[model samples]
Target: MQLILPLILFLVGFGAYEFFETRRAAYKIAHRIHVNGTRGKSSVTRLIGSGLRESGFQTLTKVTGTYPKLVMEDGTEEEIYRRTKANIIEQARMLRYAADRQVDAIVFECMAVQPQFQWIVEHQMVRSTVGVITNTRLDHLGEMGNSLEDITRALCNTIPFNGVVFTSEQKMFPLMEKIAKKRGTQLIYADPETVTDEDLRGFRYVEHRDNVALALAVCQHLGIPREKAMAGLHQTVPDSGALEVFDVDYIPYKRIRFANGFAANDPESTILVYNLVLERFDNGGKRIIVLTIRDDRLERAEQLAEAIVQHMPCDYVLLVGDSTDRVHDVLTALNFPRQQAISMGVASGEEVFEMVLDLTDDRSIVLGIGNMVGKYKSGTQIVNYFRHRSHITPKLEEETRA
Candidate 1:
């Protein structure tokens, strides 16, 4: 009984200390921007940080994407080394780091998917001055919810109390606004019409118009001029998993164009990426789809398989990554041609590449979708293998956007 009292007292004291320290750290920074949503959180976080820095705010940013990173004030970024699986507590540590640096602003990509964690991250850890939702979509449904409305509600957990929030999600604006009002927050719609194709041409990658427009709106609200903010955005470093294309000569007579859309795992985002890449690079070649499936993301694999059957017209479907048998079965059950769907179970990057070559003719378009990183899948390796073999002219380098 005596020991129990002491243990309880120690636990309570530690909890109180942590709470005070975290809030203190958050208050030390002048501005805090919390970015959440299903699709473009990392891209929007990087954009806002770059623009804030350009406007002379000593900014720091942390993005959990294909490659997790910490973007410093001088626009230099360092990969965030993790010793274990990611946790929400990292936000507290990031805030402490930013407070120590005495930065003028910090933009964080929301890393929590579970609705409860999302609420705790924003209300307890970040307590952001500005919030950004980069468009809610059908993603993390296992953690967020099953429907789009459910996902939007889960994402709105990060909407700052008594502060302003922004989003480019036109369809869900009404629901978002209702939630924002209840929290004493004002929601603003970022009009993508303001961001022109000419502005997009300045990018070194195929950045979506909605992402740029959303980030621009956040920056403008922070008092950065559109001209200056755009200049910074143009110079912004894209996430490692950002949409990129490579045209490679695989053999003496064969050539292939590869587009990396592995990061867009959700059905809506995946379809958009498919349409974008197909529109830009379809050279009348055989359309090939390489879908990488993670063991834990079998549900996503099923979703993508259904979406592909309905939307993405293709000549062949190559299933890679862990537990390929399940996804192949899904494709077969969906009435996808059994012969066309090839299940190369847990294949290496080179093995997948070889299969892609075998499926391709003289000219082909190969689109990679689904999870980028997994215990068994290495989308980075596959992308790098193609990049190393690409002999396209110097003018068409990896830096070339569209």
Candidate 2:
């Protein structure tokens, strides 16, 4: 009985100390932006930071998507290696890091999945002046909820008190607005249509218009000129896992075009990128879709399979990773041709590389989607294999044959 009192008091003291420390660190950084959403959080965070730095602010940014990285004011980023697993307490540490550097602004992608942690990250740790939600999509429904309304309500938990919020989510704007009103925050909806083709052409790599629009809205709200902000955005380094395409000549007269869309895990984002790739690439080529499954994400695998079956048209569907059986089952139930669906279960990067070479011919386009990194192969590893194989020119092939 006596030990309980001391334990309770000790915990209370620790909590109080953490709270004050977080507040002190937050006070040192003037402009703090918390980016939270179903998708594009990392891209928007990077864009906003780049835009601010272009406007001459010493900015610090952190992203928890694709991979965790701490971006410095000089545009250099260092991978954040965690001794333990992911924890929301990292945000408090990030606040101290920003304060130590004496940065003018800090932009952070919200890392927490739980509702309480999200609220704590916003109200206690970051206390951001500007909040951005890229969109409300059906993702992490297990943590948030099953319905879109529930997802929106959960995402709105981070709306700053008496601050401003921005989003590209048109369907849930009313819910966001109501939350902003309750919190005394102003909500701004960024229309994706406002970002024209010319504006998109400015980006070095393929990027979604919605993400660009949300980032532009936030930068403009912060008093940055659209032109200057875009200039900085153009210079921003894309995340290593960002969607990209590469062309490879594997042998004489045979070529393969690879589009890396593994980072877009959700069905909606995956389908959107699939359509975009179809529009951008050569229509005459044989289209192949590679879906990598994760054992931990069975629901994701099933959802992606359904999305592909319903919307995406392809000559072949190659399945990889631990959860290939679940995907194969889904495809079978849908009456997809057994021959058209190839399950390369638990294959290494090299094996997958050979399989792709065998499946594709001259004028073939391969779209790699689903999880970026898997147990047997990583997206980077597969991409590298194709790149290295492509280097075997006609002359090299002839030399080998001779």
What are the lDDT figures for the candidates, one per model?
A: 0.89, 0.85
| TM-score, every prediction | 0.96, 0.94
Clashes of 2: 0
Tens-digit per-residue lDDT, 1-402, candidate 1? 989999999999998998889999999998999999889889989988888888899999999999789999999989888899999988999999999999999999999989999999999999999999999898887888889999999999999889999999998999999999999999999999999877887887788899999999999998889999998898889888888888887676788888889889898899999999888767679899999888898898899999999999899999988888888998999999999999987787888788888887788889999988888646777777777777555544433444
- How many residue-pair clashes does candidate 1 contain? 0
For the record, the alpha-carbon RMSD of candidate 2 to the native fold, in angstroms, is: 4.8
Q: How many residue pairs clash in each candidate?
A: 0, 0
State the displacement of the C-alpha of residue 331, model 2, in Å, after optimal TM-score superposition: 0.6
Candidate with the greatest TM-score versus the true structure: 1
Spell out the clash pairs found in candidate 2: none
Task: Judging by lDDT against the true structure, name the best candidate.
Answer: 1
